[model samples]
Target: MRRAPWIRLLLWHASAAIPVLGAAAAFYGPALERTGGAWPAPLDDVYIHFGFARAAALGHPFSWIPENGYSSGGTSLTYPLALAPGYLLGFRGAWLGLFAALLACAALLDLCRSLRRLLEPRGGPGAASSRWVGWVGWLAPLFVVAVPLLDWSWFSGMEVALLGAVLGRALVAVRRAELAPPARRPAEQLRAGLLAALLVATRPEAIALAAPLAVAVAHAAGSLGAAASLARASLPTALLLGAQAAANRAFTGEWGAAGAVRKLLLSNPYPTPLEKAVEVIKNLAALRVQALESALGGPWLSLVLPLLGAVAALDRRSRRVAVPLLLGAYGSLLLVALNATARYQNLRYAAPSLAMLLLAAALGAEALARRGRLAAGVAAALAVAALAAPSAGFARQIDHFARASANIAGQHVEVARRIAARAPRRVLLGDAGAIPYLSGIPAIDGLGLGGYRGMPFARASVHGVPAVVELIERLDPAERPDVFALYPSWWGGLADVFGRRVDAVKIDDNVMCAADEKVIYEADWSALAPPGERRAGVIDEVDIADLMDERAHGYAFPSPRGGWVIGAVLPGGGDGAGGGGGAGGGGAPRFDAGRLIPEGREQSFTIDAAAAIARGPAVLALRTDGGGPIALGVAALRDAGGEARVEVPERPAGRWSEIRVPLRDVAPGDRIRIRSLLGTFRSFHVWLLRP
Candidate 1:
């Protein structure tokens, strides 16, 4: 019996640990500084897990929004669980993720060393150790560390690293049984089965790898062998998944995790099987487009390295061990191709598969070693050159980590602080991750990731405008936001839907709201009739086209605008503050001939009578649809008392109210004001034009 290769294993593992440690320090050191020693993961998704883990640690159920009931917003079963013990110890945040990542790297190194020993047995008959081939296995860990996706994923608080490690262990066990066929070790089979079950629970995508692997391991015994292997793999996997589903159902009133629903919703608006198939194809195309640069490093390396790996995998001596690596890589990629919707961010979806491919590349280099020193050197040179670009990309990602922590994550923390300071009570919010998590508020997640599922704008499509509108619309009255502080530009077409003009106080560069009292638009604006016919300039002289009942003049507007206008009497304000129209819902002003304009587009109105503003500062109040405020500019104005020109800027609410524009020396009866509807407004009403 040969003694254990403890020295060699330790040396190989140490070699791998060096780069991982160095990278961790380089990336996480600055992240610590940026986050003031908390070392929060850069991605928003990381907090999604942290929220769950923190709850779990506190002896509460997993939930992104704790007040919102049991929410299975977390995607991984084991990751949050892994964070549990440490969180119980009061050590939470990126440090936990980083430690998990280090363990995963060490596991990968051990798996590679074990696999090398299996392929080239020591002290066995006719077994001559190949020195260069040994170097390939030793160097393989370096490849794993260098993959850009793996680097970011390790720090992302995601399950990628852990999944790869467990999956590698499972493959090694199954391949061991296959290598010594006809003598199936029940112990190894049981170990492999347990690992496979954990793999499924880890990411769910490993089912692709697990199924094929079980069959391959059982192939020698014909039908009977296959059945046994299938049962062994299937039973444990089924039990774990079934138990999870039952727990999820009991806790959240849903069978699967909320994340599954969110992903499915993101994949297709129509949840039919056929639409799902179409979605997979679309996702595949996107993956292909992004795969070369993001996953495989670049065009040239992606093409060349895989061909070399294929050649090495085909060799008879390397076939037994090589097959599983190739299968793992291809199966993982297929899983990503079918399931992953988000294709960018450099191999995030296919991270485990990349580890497999890296091993295959090393195997290919090993096969080259057998041919000659020159061939091995060439393979090594190409591998190094191919890795250079990703190394640079990884460096940039470190910078991304720091910047995101400072700008995005830090801003969220600050905003949550301000919100807490201003509104001590819980508030409904969009981008529910950081704000609620930081502020300890009970929030309604507009994106539904935090488990508020009544998102009307939640669609399979990535278009955010419709999603946000639907999210806001779907909220229960009780769940309506006090003030929405989201990026308005992201909510496309909202300016059209909400009639684009209201009185608002600008809060941050991104925030604008009326403090619980301002009306965005008059409720009766939708009752106004469409402008009839294209009458030239000031229709009907004094009236400007009847100023009521939708008979307003259409100028500088789109053509054939009768049906283009749609109206809705939006429900009264959720805050229960404003009265619409009149006290008894009578004598309210009607707005008509309103047009929805594209963002950054403006429309103007010219008033011929200078006496319109003769009475003190002329009032030019306009009604608007209520999403928020719209800017109105009044230029080339006049006072009724004399030939005094003035320009006034005003933002009006969703009412028939008037803005008091100041006048120099106009008398109380004298009026002088010009109307120029500015920014994006639903409709402008001129009361003075009434006949």
Candidate 2:
């Protein structure tokens, strides 16, 4: 039996995927160990996510405390947020997020090559198709592994990248199997269905991948086999879906609104899914520029790929895979919208389609050009290089994982711990959910995305400040709660809300918990500040939250020119911070640009002088909304020009941190405006304030 050159070619390319995988493994080796980090509720939330999923598997209530011990945010329903939990369980908490990312990259390359294989045999230079797979495999490690390491903080635990790979591979499998016999095609189609289902299970919106797979499935089905094929192919998908449905039913008690799908399954006034999709698209388009920047390491590179992808799709040779490729790309882009953190999403989100399209572009380039070898070689080199650099970085970081745990070891978690310890068993706090979940303290709401939906977040009975005060008054008599950790936003009529029962205490600094007041004040907040570190210097910096982007590591607010984020809007938004966190980033008239405000709207900044300035800039510094996409940055007045937008390292939206700039250049009476960097020129989209 003579072996075909193509099979050997594919096998060789597949075999070559090892070093690329190994390289990726080497770079992100550190994350493979610990689960929790100093960051927000992503990985830990995943722990909570898996806890609920595993609980569903075992038939337990969705509670982070599991048995006892208070926590906040119960039973979060967002399954995509929980995918890491499955990996943690399977990988034994190896933090295989990086691995998933690498796999996704590889999968995209595979998608390109397989599609090439199908197209080449017909008219696209079929025999030479096998060689292209190697380059695709080469890119797997590059984009997935290396690029993410450029910034140590962009570690989103590899969920997006990995799931993307699974999606791309599934598409590739569908593409490769498209030419299968009518008799055997049913099985191939079923495989595609299973792949699509897995993707949906990993991420709720991932059902977008199904559109392209459906195209591929329909393409493969014979006229006579259409009815039977749809049935056969859709069965495995149905089974997986059923499994998710049962899990959803177990937790949420409804089949349609099961698992993480519950969030999407609900009836909304937005009407049809298309409307929801429209809303999602609106949000995505707002961050398109930023998403591109985040993906490419800078803003300009982000612009090139999509533009190039669009161009490639238009090519005559690429027409076959172009529509599906574009659909996948558009679908992938949706993941960045209307949720949180659009920055890094631009990078990971487009990987599946981008990777595929690039490969397809490369394949098309090869098929159409006399310099196919040179063209493919260059493309392959860049792809391999992208994979290699990160793999190298991972090797360097692996040794630091253990050190990372010990170095900062539970420093931040301790805050949540002490407050929970001092408070009563069932006490509630503003951020009780996250604080307790991280510190293992039992606070009010412990559920995250999934569990939190069903939990009591707000009650109509306790809506107003006076009503809240009354609820607090009632609590002592019945709920018997002790401490109250009030976030400033809730601090509103809360005292009035709690009636005479809850006492709203304003701590002088950021430190809290009476138990460690001395240490918290002396050591925690103030102690970290350098001597004379209180100047108005952070003004020159850029804030990405202005762009509705949340994927930042930490903010670098220079000397305290202003200590607090002053909530201010131009005189036109109806005076004061009345609109806080409502339409335009709640109060700023920006922040929520795409949703609540129009594009290209511009307004001025104004602040009240007789108000509570918090002794310095602590109260004067304008705080932006953390609700919209992150990267919501603050741009200080400089050069009398308000055209620059930069990514803010910090994304703490609720807390007021000062932004100080050298006022030497501008006169004392100059009117300065600080608006959200969110991409909207609309006056509504721009938050305006003058301090």
Model 2 residue runs over 4 Å out of place are 1-44, 53-136, 149-155, 223-282, 297-322, 340-412, 419-424, 427-443, 446-486, 490-691
TM-score of model 1 vs. true structure: 0.63
Per-residue CA lDDT of candidate 2, range 1-691, in tens?
A: 6358688667646754664456445434443343244322122333344344334433444444444311122322333234434444563222333333444445434533443343343333334553553344333323333434322222334344445455556655566456567666767777777776666555555555565666557656765366565665456556766775675455433444322221231222123566666666665665454333443435544443444445445655444345565666667666545333333322334444344444443434333332366756654544443333333334334444323332222332444555545555544444323344444444433112323323212221111232222223222233323344444344443322232332232322221122212111110111111222222422222222121111121222111111112122221222123112222122222211112222222223322233332322211233333333322223334444443343334323342222222222332222344344554211112222223
Q: For residues 63-91, what per-residue lDDT tens digits would candidate 1 score against the true structure? A: 66555656666777777777677667656
Q: Kindly give the stretch of ten consecutive residues in candidate 2 with the minimal lDDT sum.
A: 518-527
Alpha-carbon local distance difference test for all models: 0.52, 0.38
Instruction: Output the number of the lDDT-best candidate.
Output: 1
TM-score for candidate 2, residues paired by index: 0.50
Residue 21 local lDDT, model 1: 70
**Top candidate, metric TM-score:** 1
